[model samples]
Target: MSLRARAATTLVLVAAVLGLGLAIAVHHDPAAGADNATLRWFLDHRTPWATHLATALSTVFAPMWVAIAAVVVSVGLIRRDQILDRGMRVLGTVAIAGALAEVFKLAINRLRPPTIDQIGSPEAAASFPSGHVTGTAALLLAAALTVTASRAARTTAITTASLLSAAVAVSRLYLGAHWLTDVVASIAVAVAAVIAAPVVVDAVLAALRPHLPLRLRSMVDVGGRTSVEAAR
Candidate 1:
């Protein structure tokens, strides 16, 4: 599929999942039984080692770690040249995806699983969409798309990143922090963001190119040299 078509499909799937989840939440339906059962299974399977591993995954994808990663990636991009091109695309995807997840959380306003049923302390925020999963998926998928690396290396990076992101999503469920649908929808949002990032970045650069300083324009003109182009 075309990039735009893929992104649109992902977004439509996200909307469908979100709508179903919302309807279930609103009606207090028995469909939640599956969610509860899944949560219970995770809770029942919790071992110290598993808990430690999940905790580590959660910590690595925490807001603080994400910010640190952004700064590090930003600096690396600056050193490589084309911050407005590559850096902005990566950072913008993460920021926009995160904001979208937060907006959905607020809009859905679904309560998280009870603390008594959870492995850790209860989260205070609404939890229809998982922020951790959303951010991790966006960051990893963006990196997979934007990193300047060998094909084999890039494939390895994406594979590892995807597995890690999935692990983090499972961690959220294991911790009883979010429902299955929440994580699934967040993954869709991330995929959509990754697919759209280059398109958005290219459009923005095209619009700004004419007005930018000659030196800046020249640097950003290389923006077309992206993995998205390579795919074609």
Candidate 2:
């Protein structure tokens, strides 16, 4: 692998190790007093307008909605940039991150915060990782990675993504839907997915090229070349 790919692999491995440790820690102490304390603090400190904003952010940034937005964004990238690989990276990152959050939720099966309003919150049953934040983070990170045209644009994109992700994560806590640990774990997992997306999506496209229709094979061929370059 190239130095960039190797660096990304190292980061992914590190995230996996830390995530495993967190899962073990959370399993032993689901309440995670400090985490719950932070969640409660956010709830306690919220103003009416702040609460409304938090609720809106949490609802709007739900995993399903974010996934839908990702699809739209990916289509736009493909159509405008004429780069299938870039679009696939964006979609794949969000999908992979969302899947990781779900798997962790199932494996941990950790209960949501006691103060959480079960009604209208579909993912309130299990909450070791915040699915909304995971999807949001992945979508924004993928955008930052693939959509920028210059160094200044890249910086702006990264800044916007970081701020939006932080807001979404805090919204989950403020709404009493998740503990601090849940959002933190979701961000970590999302980071791993974003870092891996370029290589992973390209590799998958390359593998699928032969199976695609003749007209579509050429589109997949572009991604295959990217896969080879990424692996160099």
Candidate 3:
């Protein structure tokens, strides 16, 4: 099968799994574990650890990563290097996916676990999807696409990004700030961003590449010599 077909299949599988999980959660008593012994034990013994971990994940999911991406693109533009600028095209997909995430969050409005012991509860939001996870997924996807040079590198970046994103979501649960569903929602947001960005970026860059200056036109042959013409 073609690469596109394979990717589509994978996405379908993921959606199916997510759907099954949601069905089960919806049918079950998600809130029955408020007084679970394991959670209480952790709250009693590892409060500090949970707090620290959550805080750290929060930082990773901050807007700072987006700002950094803009900077990277800008720098690439200034240098007349086209690669980074090309990645900007993908950023739009990220934005749309993020917006979708918020919409879903609002619609689901699932409550956070009461006994999770976090800073705030999702009073009117779905706990199944996580906004932080979404943001992290978006940022990581954009970054990974921007630097897609190797299979190992892409795998590593995705892995790292996933771990960090998951950590943030887990932290929310550990801190009692959110439920597992909330974290999952956030991850859905992020995953959608990544999944959509590449296709969008490809179309955009293809349309724009023709307008780039000669100096940065060749990413594959970036080292090709070019003579600058003197200003008239």
Q: Please give, for residues 96-153, the per-residue lDDT of candidate 1 as tens digits.
A: 7787788788778888888776777778688778889988998887777665568888
TM-score of 1: 0.85
Question: How big is the positional error of residue 128 in model 1, measured in Å on the Cα after superposition?
Answer: 1.2
lDDT of 3 by residue, 73-187 (tens): 5455335443434446445645755676656655545565563365543343455565556666666655655544579988887788777666766665566655554555456
State the TM-score for model 2.
0.81
Best by TM-score: 1
Question: Which portions of model 1 miss their true places by more than 4 Å?
Answer: 1-7, 28-31, 213-215, 218-232
lDDT of 1: 0.76
Candidate 2 local lDDT, 53-156, one digit each (tens): 98889888977899899999999876665446677889999988888778777877777877444223545478768888889999998989774457999989
Deviation of model 1 at 119, angstroms = 2.4
Provide the lDDT at 44 for model 3. Answer: 72
The local distance difference test score of model 3 is 0.56
Q: Which regions of candidate 2 deviate over 4 angstroms?
A: 1-27, 116-123, 210-232
RMSD (Cα, Å) of model 2: 4.9
